[model samples]
Target: MPSPRRTARQADLLERLVALLVAEGFASFTLDDLAERLRCSKTTLYQLAGTKQDLVREAVKHYFRGAADAVEKEIAETVDPASRVQVYLTTVAEQLSSLSRAFLDDMAQFPPAREVYEANTRLAADRVRNLIAEGVAAGAFREVHAAFVGEVAAATMRQIQLGEVGARIGLTDSEAYEQLASLIVHAVSS
Candidate 1:
């Protein structure tokens, strides 16, 4: 195992890398550029995170983990399943809205980043599936396939992220979330 100091330093490096990615589109920067931005040497970066792809994967995972934690907190605080689902979707939508446009633009420019992106997407989907399964077990939702509902919810969120449908409807992130929550509740509730 790594020493605590090493672990903390790695964490800090990861945060800096993520901040750089969020600020400057990923396509605009090379590893050397990232090292310059972070005021560190490329060797240090390689030591901290194996490769650029690994760094991106860690950054994406960290981002999604934070988002999932926020949504889980909202779900835990709500009483009813419907309200919980609403809070969850709303939280996700709000997060997506808060994301830097440069970040999205970067994802569009660098297709390799999609691998990391998709991993985060799968993590989010798994969380939704677990939430749905819990609601079903608690006799809150209908007798449908939790996995299917979770996949659909995840796909819908991705659509929103891609700016395919939700934004066109004048749905602020919050409004889009409310709409999604309503749809999910209607689908799952008997």
Candidate 2:
């Protein structure tokens, strides 16, 4: 087993590397490429994972988990139901702002990374559904089936990621998500 200090140091390295992975991509970058970009030795990166694929998968998972946790924390601090959903959407967009198209495509190409993304998507949908219920109860939102609306919102978000809505409308994916938050807030406003 690795020493606790060594494990902590490896975790720190992963944190440093995830941003590079987001801006560049995982699919095409070699281990040497990653080491050079990170300004670290290849051996140091190897200590984080046995192989490049494992490192990419683990970093992608860490990114999603960290982003999700931050969103949840922000939502928890708010009592306003409308703000809860808005916070969720806004935080999601902000977290993904640095992510490049190439990086996103790489995630889609990797099954393990894709699974991590999909899991976050599902969790966001559930949280949105709950927020809708809260909003309706508090009369902050119009009377509607919260579950169905949340599912629709989640589905639309997926299309935005696919570049369908953003492509036709000439907006980036991050911009599309911001627009979506606005639309959702207005649609449910009482």
Q: Taking the tens digit of each residue's C-alpha lDDT, what string does model 2 give over 1-190?
A: 2223347777778888998888888888999998998888999998877799888987887888788888888888988887877887888888778788888888877888887787777777788888889999998898989999899888977777556776698777677778878888888887
Off by over 4 Å in 1: 1-6, 109-112, 136-148, 161-163, 166-178, 186-190
Superposed by TM-score, candidate 2 places the C-alpha of residue 135 at a distance from the truth, in angstroms, of 0.8
The window of 10 residues in a row where model 1 has the poorest summed lDDT is 1-10
Clashing pairs in 1: none
Task: Compose the digit string of candidate 1's lDDT tens values, residues 79-188.
Answer: 87655665777677766665566776666455656655666567666777877787888888888899999989888766655555544775544456568778888888
Report, for every candidate in turn, its global Cα lDDT versus the true structure: 0.70, 0.82
Point out the worst 10-residue segment of candidate 2 by lDDT. Answer: 1-10
Candidate 1, number of clashes: 0
